[model samples]
Target chain A: MRFINVIKVALRALRRSAMRSILTALGIIIGVAAVIAMVSIGNGAKSQVEASIASLGQNIISVYPGSATTGGMHGGWGSASSLTVDEALTIRREISGIVAVSPEMRDRQQVLANGLNWNSSVNGEDVTYLDIRLWTIAEGEMFTEGDVNSAAKVCVIGQTVVAKLFPDGDPVGRSLRIRNLPFKIVGVLKAKGFNYFGSDQDDVVIIPYTSHLKRIARRPNLNSIIIQAESPDQMTRIQQDVTDFLQQRRNGRDPDFTVRNQQELAEAATATTKTMTVLLGAIAGVSLIVGGIGIMNIMLVSVTERTREIGIRLAVGAHGRDVLTQFLVEAIILSVMGGTLGILLGVGSSQLISRLNGWPVLVSTSAIVGAVAFSAAIGVFFGFYPARKAAQLDPIEALRYE
Target chain B: MSHVVQLEDIHKTYESGEVPVLAVRGVTLTITGGEFVAIMGASGSGKSTLMNLLGCLDRPTRGRYLLGGTDVSNLDRNELADLRNQKLGFIFQGFNLLSRTTALENVELPMLYGRRHFSTREIRERARQSLDIVGLSNRADHFPSQLSGGQQQRVAIARALINEPQILLADEPTGNLDSKTSVEIMGVFQKLNAQGITIVMVTHELDIAHYCKRNLIMRDGRLVSDTPVVDRLVATEQMQRIVTAETDAKLIA
Candidate 1:
């Protein structure tokens, strides 16, 4: 028989049992839809995490002092005063890949400005702090290195502080009192949203470490140092250089500081999300296999039910190959049609979910194409046996079937 | 006259579980072109098996069977199918018209599998002509379920004739119909035979066998008798007599 005529006959046969065909296709529909939806949701979450990690800082490394131990009572990391402002400057000058470095000291302090009082974290850092943290001054210029050298009482306030203390007016060029000492606001930092730990990132004030030691906290050995590499590719090299330099400075006495890079943190976080994505994709894949089995089951039933029709076709001169092609084509048409509908449903539902839950979801084009192709493969894989059964039937016996 | 079918000592055996049953044992026959012949037998006398062999629906287990000069007894399944498509048409006891299909589409079915490529337009035109030959052109759009038994049989005949086969093989074509409808269906066969189409039909009814020009009787898996009908019954005349008798009985009642 001509290929088109065989296809026509298959379609006509399927149309004769439209409701049954649809019911048979439903399994594939749900399977493909689940695969698409699950994969999209997983990819969305992974990318969201990556974006958040990117926002933290690029190629950043933090060096914190080892824990303080007094009389065998040990405090946690960054409790000892091992790192100093001199070491921070020396590393910045000596390291090849180092772009900037800052010594950091943090304390919670009450601030008074414009007849309002707010309690916010006060951070003492050098001029390189902004560069290492990838923070920008949105309102006014940053305090210069000269200001740090002079122990100038100048500060950069974050957006959360601005919203709290300077709600009615701009804080730049204005003085705010921290711990009863007045400090002039040099810049207002741009708003940085919440971190992965759900803490407000824009709830702090930054002042020169020298100024902080002289005017606010009084005595402070450097708590930690933040370093920035020239590029992300140079992070590990710079980290190793810093570690060796710090070890030499400490006389290699069991390492008094810990050097941690932002890449490590990002990799750890992304690993978890990647595992989750694969898990979801695998679960969805199981459903697809189940759907393939369902197709096989229905196709077997269809072959049995159409025995007489197959006999009639054979009697009218249809070859066994023609009958086989007809049934196989029917199965393929069902799966492909189901796959198309599933893709539409998946995309539509993903969009609906994004709208309702405010979650990011990415419907990849490759995924859609892969799903359609896979379903077609499933049709072929599952449709073969039943079609062969129909083809091998004895026409005389089939015609005589009641 | 060239013979359309020549069976040389054909034998068919059935392997039923542990027992082998001989269905047709050494049946030899020859049917020429344009001859209307009927094979008659009891239920287990192997007449149906002979029809199956003649239709190329089954390969003879032993002996030579030639259809239109092609030795078909040893042909493979696909070749036999091609022979059936190109050389023979089949009409079943139950008018095997596809139920949901229109009569026109049912008639177009055989052409769909024809060896010659037929365009859709040509297929439709030829199907209409075949239906016209069966006097079913007006009922072309009706489905088999919607048609009467005789109309369905006529549609099946149209389907059979669409391929322009050399021979028509009908197995109990009127077994499901009333006697009046049987005569009406036989009239269609006679008309096709008069147009030079060879026909081989199977029936148990002796009266039905008398409608053909020749009768072959089978018994115990063998051909017991093969004879030309001395006084063949004309299907149209018999149909007219049946109608008249029915009308007179209705008038008397």
Candidate 2:
């Protein structure tokens, strides 16, 4: 019954000063909305990273040449003297825990189909490269292992390159020119969209690894070695095995080689996303603290304005605790109302982002509950001083107050 | 046999900077059940302070204050609040009706804070009864600001009477009214007092004090005189004649 009267008084006072109450609530609204929006964007970025890492295939490992820069013509070396084709063959034959191996060679070159010509990365790797990297042909067929062995002049074109170079035909089995060397298009690769840096992935051509090493650049060393483990659990052991194998092959000769596992790459990306999420959330939380301060200021003013009213109630039989409860209820109502509105706006904004930019967004139940609870806590914490001040007022002085 | 209020050697001193300003000093008084008493003093004569002490709104700095056999001056804050809720009702000089509340709700305020529960209909009915006692039943829905000073004072009187307190304490209850409104408010008080309700009014007007059966005049926070009015100024019959005469004048106009 006492609580009901407190709410009644709060509602009455709020109605009396509608504009001030709404303005006070606006602070809470902004605070809650900021928290939710920041968290959602954080979650969205995280999921985007996870999707990118997932596309890279969890079973694969990547190896790149050391320094591709030693004594260059301009920007260092054209390619390193490390990672020969012999090493790739040796890893394939000797590494016990390794399930598959694919050596990759890539260079930026101009490729032409009919009259259309564009500069794009032309990657040279075998059939196992596609299997280990989880790349699938969306049309026609892949180059055979025989084609790889023979350094066949056949290629798989990416979606963007296909669209740009062959707008009017299938281009499959059609011959394309890679800087004066002709290669038939064996397949059209599926669209991989963007990488972590928002760079286009569907702009490369894939050809036999030996074709680029022998016929294209005529280089003896490898740029990168890609491998796949039998299972995700064997990734660490397989990484060690491959490292040891390379070291032994080089006669413990400071091989200057590094092996990156899929798990480590995923962990690094997740940690980065988590850090970004916390930083954004902390920035938003500062606004909530400011909003709480606003509540405290307004509550103190309200207590002063209602001092005589408090006295009247006290003289008419309201306890000091009743006065405290009434003002506290008002503060709570303001914060909870603001929190509810902010959650709605935040969720709506996240959905808008997802729709506009095709970014992944998720609004978790915990964030909603957490925002509401945090707003309520702000109300109680900030409302206490004012409520206590009002409650401790001398009734005689308060009654005499103008 | 029982007194509604009793004060023995009450003294209240307020500090103004370093010196203590005596607001009420060495005062003793008593109001038995069913008595109408008026406290009279000049401005700053400590009449308001005396009323506050009588209404249980403030404690005397040093004194024994008993309300209906209970020593109220020694009571704690909560106890005083409970005592005020149960035993005392107040009508102030400014009426002091809660501005936003309707006349009926204002009358019901004391009951709302009481320990008992009343249904909405019951509360409304009781408030209506109190308003009817003050002849403002038709204006139960009117807000304090909407009413005339006399009507507002009557509404305040209704609020004071709703709790059926052991004593009705009125502090300068007619100070804000014109002569005619003052007479009307005093008539209402007289009617309530005739129903055997104890009334203690603090006022400065001689005419207002003359309406009470007993009068106490204060000087420098001390009661200088306590005497019964040999012939009450309004005297019931003369006030009725004047009211009828005014109605006739209004009709003539």
Candidate 3:
């Protein structure tokens, strides 16, 4: 009953100064709105990065040729041609839980078709390369293993290569020249826009590794090997097996290859976005603190302004504790109302920004719940001092206050 | 009649900077139930201090005060507030009614602070009844600014009486009103007093003091005289005489 009375008193007092109350609540509104909107944008960017990484294919591990040493000089990763097609085939036969493998050998070459020439990365890969990388064939059929064994001059062209070399129609079955050597286009790959590194993924062509090794570049070494594990849980075990097998293949000598999994690359990629999210969130949180301080300032002024009213209530037998509760309840009401409004504003604005800027915005449920709960805590924390100050005033002096 | 207030050598002193100012010194008094008494003095005569001590708004510096048989000197702030709520009703010279609030809500204020919970219906019913007793039943919804000075004072009185306090303490209840409104407020008091309500009023007006049965004059922090009024004025009769005199003089307008 006493609680209800104080609530009634608080409500009446708030309504008495409706404009001041609304202005005070506006501080919290902007603070919470900033928090929610900023977090949504941050989360949206994060998920977008994650989705692009996921498109790299699930549960994949890539092995690259490690750095090479000669006396005092050291050549970095990818500088050493330290792997071969024979070693890749040996791993495929020896490793268990392996789904698919693509031994890759890449070279940049100027390709000419119908009197137009363009420089593009020409990769030599196996028949299972598309499946391992989760790339789909858009037109025609993949070159068979028989074509790989024979070092056939047949290839699959990427969307960028098709756009550049064959703008008229489908280039499937058409022939394009690489280094004055003609290679027939067997299939066309679906377009993938770009990776996180800002490099075009669709500007490429693929041919059998045997063809590149035996005919085009005449190199015995493979650039890298891409392997797909059956599932995410087996990635670690499969990675360990591959490393140990490669090391053993080196006859107990130092291995000349570096292994990396998809998750590690994804984590490294998302770290920057995570930092940005926290930075934006912290800046938004500072505004919330300032909002809390605003509440405290207004409550203190309210206590001083209503001194005589406090005296009247005290004289009428209201306890000092009752005054404290009434003021605290008023602060909480202001902040909670602001918080609710902030949530609506935040969600609406995020949607508007997403539409206007064409940016990905994912509003996380946890962030919404956390922001409100934090604002409520801010109410309680900032309201205590002013309320206590009001409660400790002498009724006689309060009555005498102007 | 049983004693409603008992003060024993109550002294109240204040430290005004370096000098210790004694507001009230060695004042002892007793008032029985159903008595309408007035405390009168000039400025700095300590009558307000004595009233403060009596109303339990401030404790005596060096003595004890028993209000309705309870020792109030040793009570804490909350205890005194509860005691004031339950046992005493206070009226101020300024008619300290909350502005913008309806008279009914002002009357209901005391009940809202009371310990025992009253249902909404009961609180509204009792507040309306209190307003009716003060003859402002129809003005229950009127704000303080909307009402006349006398009406506002009456609303304060109604608020004071809502809790059924054993004693009503009025600090210059008629101080802000003109002679006619003063007597009219006096008439309201006389009616409530006639119904056996104990009232303690502090006033400087001799005629206002004359309305009470007993008068205690204070000077220089001490009680100079305590005497019963030889010719007590009845508020109802005084208001009637004023009305008749006005009609005879043609000053009704």
Candidate 4:
């Protein structure tokens, strides 16, 4: 028989049992939809983590002090301050890939402004701190190098500190008392909502490190050093160079500092999300196989039910291949149609979820196409056995079947 | 007349289970074009097996069977299907018209698988003409379920004739119809045979067999008798007589 006629006949046969065909295709629809939704969710989570990391700073590397051991009682990292201001300046001048470096000292202090006292962490660093941390001034200006040279008591307040200390007016150029000493607020920092650890990022105050060392928290050793690479691609090399330089400066006695970069954080976050996506995709793939089995079951029953019809077709001059093509086409049509509907459902549901829950979802075109092709392949794989069984039927026996 | 079908020492055995039963035991038969012949036997006498072999639906276990001067006893499944399509038409006892299909489409089915490529318009026109030949042109759009038994049988005949085969093979063609409807069906067969189409029919009813020009009797899987009908019954005349008798009885009541 001609190919067109075979398709027409297959369509007619499917139409004869439209309900069964739709039911058989439902399994595939759910499977494909689940896969698409889960994958999009995974992609969304990965991008969300990347965006958070980007907000923290670009190509940032932080150096923490080494651990301390007194009388065999070992202290964890950052227990003793081994880094100093001179070392931070040396890294800035000597490292070829280093763009900016700042010595950091931290302390919690109570500040009184407009008769409201608020307790917030006071971060002290040089003017390079703004560049290394990618923090911008929202109101006035950052504390300049001249302020650090003379140990001037000028500060930059973050959004949370301003909200608590000066609720109705701008805090720039306003006088605030910290540790019974009067300080002038030079700027208000821009808002950065939260970090990956759910801590408020804009809840601190920044001051000149020279002022911090002379008056606020008289310390000889620095807490940590923050460095920024010239570009994102140079981060790993810069980190290695910094590590080697620190080891040499410390006489290579098990290096007193540890270097960490944003790339490692991003990679760790991405790996977790990717693992979840693959796990969800694998679970959905099982449903697709189950859907294929459903198709096989329905096709087998169809072949048995239409045995006499097949016999009549054979008696009238239809080849076995013709019968095989007819059933195979039916199976393919069912699965392809289901796959198309599944894509629509998946996209719509993903959008709905993102909108309702305020989560990110990315629906890639390649994933949609791959899902459709996979379903079509599944149709062929599962449809083969039933079609072959129908084709191999003996016409005489089939015709004689009641 | 040219010989359209020739069988020599044909045998068929059925190995349904452990015991082997011979359905047709070494029977030789020859049928010529334009001849209307009927094979009559009781059930289990191998008349159906003979019809199957003649239709090329089943191959004979022994001997040669030639169709239209071509040896076809050993043809493969596909070749046999082609031969059946090109040279033979079959009418089953059950009026085996596809239930959900209209009369016209049912008649168009055979040509869909025919060797010659026919356009849709030509197929439709030829199917209409075949239905007209069986006096079913008015019911072309009706499904088999909507038609009476006799009408359904007529549609089956139209389907059988749509391919324009040289020979028509019928297995108990009127077995499901009333006596009057059976006579009407027989009249249609006779009309086709009179138009120079050879027909081989299987019927156990003697009255139905007498409508043909010749009769072959089978006993124990063998052709025990072959003779020309001494008093052939014309189906049209028999149908007219039945109608008149029913009318006369109704008037007497």
| lDDT on C-alpha atoms for all candidate structures | 0.86, 0.82, 0.87, 0.84
lDDT tens digits, residues B1-253, model 2? 4887889999999875698989999998888998999999898889999999998888889999988988888888888887778789888887777776778888888777777777768877889999999999999988778899999999989888888899999999989998778888888888888899999999889988989999999999999999998878764665677778988889534
Each prediction's DockQ against the real complex: 0.72, 0.51, 0.58, 0.50
Per-model root-mean-square deviation over C-alphas: 3.1, 4.8, 4.7, 4.0
If you assessed candidate 1 against the hidden native complex, which CAPRI class would it receive? medium
Candidate 2 has a DockQ of 0.51
- Stretches off by above 4 angstroms in model 4 are A49-61, A67-77, A89-102, A112-116, A125-156, A169-188, A208-211, A227-248, A252-275, A364-370, A381-384, B13-21, B145-148, B176-180, B240-253
Question: Just chain B of model 1: what TM-score?
Answer: 0.97
Candidate 2 is graded, for docking, as medium
In model 1 chain A, the worst 10-residue window by lDDT is A381-390
Ranking by lDDT: 3, 1, 4, 2
**Model 3: per-residue Cα lDDT over B69-171, one tens digit each:** 8788899999999988889999999888887688998999989989999887899999999999999999999989999999999999999999999999999
- The digit string of per-residue lDDT tens for model 2 on A277-363 reads 899789878877777677667656665557777778788877888777777788788878888898999899988977798988878
- The residue-level lDDT of candidate 4 at A336 comes to 83
Provide the lDDT at B9 for model 2: 96
User: Which has the higher DockQ value, candidate number 3 or candidate number 4?
Assistant: 3
lDDT of 1 by residue, B1-253 (tens): 7988899999999986688889999999999998999999999999999998899898788999988887888888888888888788899898877768889999998788777788889999999999999999999999899999999999999998888899999999999999888999999999999989999999999999998999999998999999998889999889778878988889534
Worst 10 residues of 4 chain A by lDDT: A382-391
